[model samples]
Target: MKNDNVILGIDLGTSAVKCVAMSTSGGIVATTEAAFPLTRDLPGQAEQNPADWLTALELAVTRLGRDVTMNAVAIGLTGQLPTLVCLEGAKPLPSAITWMDSRADAWASSFLDDSKRQMMYDRTGMPIDGRYLAPMFRYHRETFDNGVGTILSAKDFLHFALTGELATDPSTAAGYGLYDLDGANWSQELCAVWGISSSLLPTVRPSASASGLREAVAARLGLPSGLPVTVGCADSVASAYAMAGLDSGTVCITSGSSTIIMDSLPKPLRDSQRRYLLTPHIADGVFGREMDLLSTGTSYRWLNDLLGWENGRIDIAAARSQAGANGLLFSPYLAGGEQGALWNPNLRGVLHGLTVQHSSDDIARAYLEGVQFEIRRCVDILAEDSKIERVVLAGHAASHSATMQMLADILGRPVAAYHHRSPAAIGAALLAAPSAAHSKQMPTDKAVAVPSQLRADYEKIYRRYCAMFPAIAEAAD
Candidate 1:
């Protein structure tokens, strides 16, 4: 007989809430999604109301309740990391400071000294970025009164709202820039320097362990009271899980609002160059993953908006016509910037080699290539040890184009796309299911793209692009 109890996975994304219920056998019994608007009051400000997330969560669970069994075994929650939310006695005081927001750049620069910052990177495996919690915390302290009760990320706040639990998993805490990657805990010294209180932060927990559900929340969702809720992970980590735990020498790529490249390591790997971030795996002490975040899909969206593409309707024929793009090149740093080079908030988008001969198709193709080039840079940095064996691509953008195949050829590696449409939600479901302790079934993978025969053609173009990086950097300077 099938397991009577089901596992529920809730993903609180930047623009949507995705929920899934799964049988112990890894079958998806029910799935639901609800979307909310991401508001931008100013050019650099991206904000979302916390109430919208709560509403979406309620709606998604209610939608799921319409079809499937209600005896949920456990609930696992995931969300975009580093977005900050301030709360006063469980009430949100302001809109969430989204991960894309760059308002804290000056604040981050003011508080984090160079030596201390390097120590932080050594301890946390994360380079200093304005989006991290410590920077935003400093911004809040300088701008707001100290009386505000606590500040939490979007996921941590949602976890508390659902189960009255004040806790975070290592996966989410890793993005805070204060959590010690080596120590596997929040660094009191770092927090003190930023004038943050340790008491305001949630307790760190294992990503898959039980977080007892609260009665009030249970009644609202029609779930059984006292049910177990798994401590959730960062959405990227959850996606990694859904694809399959990073085996020895494997990497995962997710192209969303930003591009995230992650690879599993047997132990914490600190880069003296600080090219990428290392964080504890969601699966406890079993592993760690390194991350590189850059603006990839955001560049695509920028082009679409510029060309008046409505409803995500892209002219596929036009896009393909300009594959080589007549030697056009673009630097996709539209929304601030990230990664090892030029971590500048002031960096703007640039389109090089533009001329009257170049068409919209050329611009579009160049945009795609630009993003792929950035991905290749990160991959090269992470592959220094020659440990990466395979590459798995996930996320909506990865599914949308032949662009990924070009990326594979450029990297000289085969790329496989997993079947799971929303890997993060699927991974959340896997995390929620305690049956993994007793059963042997695991998530499966399906390939959507592979290495193209035109590897040599793409390589030539890739080298030309690589050769242009120094010039591009100089131009940006």
Candidate 2:
């Protein structure tokens, strides 16, 4: 690989599309982002037009400048998962149902009995949830009384728009809730359970598989025609590839709108409690064991808006309060349900022990602590099977030293903050780079350590949070 050549990684996120250019020498040449609005008017609904993703991609690449845009190199793609995109021919039907949507929660709760749910978890390694693509598709058809068409994941839809290919990678396939984890293919039995035809889904391909860029899109984006484009994995998978690269036991938490706690496993490991999700990793012979917290970053943003405080103010306010938030406890389940270490969809956010003495700063601190408590729950589960040798934090929210320190204090372990704004985008770029260049070391911020004096307080707080959770969940039930 020539040092001058650069690979382009386009990451379609929950709210925007981010593009990054990386040289063969493993340095980021340039980066740009374009935001897109998420539709949330309807209750228990979250959606976006697939067309918006393409527009954002074009806007992002155009912002990359002509020189970087025209750079002679391959392209790779990554994006959020389980976002159902229905298409007729090559055009999207209407809106793509995102992972956060919970319209099928009621149906999933009623239709999937305990026996059936266990069977699903055994087959697909996914807890039977309404947020998955299969259930979401079922809900879409029944509610709208619409006829069926082709089905695709969010990234697959983007890939088709970019290269005119109708295919999906394995990591994305797992999001369908019909993919057989053991067989590494779509499970007919599981599909039968949902009354879905496998033919509707795109053909599964390898994450690093390559396809030629469509000449029309190339001309539109000012890039070379027929450029090699790599079909990438899910955003979480891509970030894991960049940060750890098949190195088992190194857990990486990519915190964005949600926080995904994941690590590589040489073989699939199932949790008897079905707390974590097991899926295909970025490459063959590797599996991704992950648990997602659906409301970590979302809670922060919601609190900021509610308080009319700017972005970083919450973190600074959190720093003003001590470890336990002055006896206040917050449950960061603002996303209507919880995922990491808990699969209860009935759960909602709770503010416990609030008092007149409590200030906005205390609330902010408690919310941050609540998120860390959830992460600790996940980390504890991950450690149950394998020792967590290292904890690396990545994503938009990973750069905050104070927040990262709080996490370290909660987990009683050093947490290394990845020194990148978008690890998923960089990981996608790495997928396009040559195998030799994959060895480039990912830069990380200094590890945050738990203060010695506060260890006892942190431990006590974690215990109290754990004790309070079952009662809270029981009430929701």
* Model 2 quality (TM-score): 0.97
Where's the lowest-lDDT run of ten residues in candidate 2?
A: 140-149
Q: Kindly list the per-residue Cα lDDT of model 2 for residues 363-436, writing each as its tens digit.
A: 99999899889999999999998989888888654666788778888888878888787889988999888888
Best by lDDT: 2
lDDT by candidate, in order shown: 0.74, 0.87
The C-alpha TM-scores of every prediction are 0.92, 0.97
- Runs of candidate 2 with Cα error greater than 4 angstroms are 1-3, 143-147
| lDDT string, candidate 1, 1-477, tens digits | 234567888889877898888777677777898988787888668888899998888888988874353678788889988898888777876678888888887667666677877988888878786888878777756566666687788889988887787788998998777787767898998888777888888888888777677888888887888888877889888877777565657788876667677877767777777767777776555454555555566656666787888624433523464445688877677777555344555556678788998877777778777777777777888788657788888765455546656667767897776655667887888877776632322344454456677677777777887787656566653
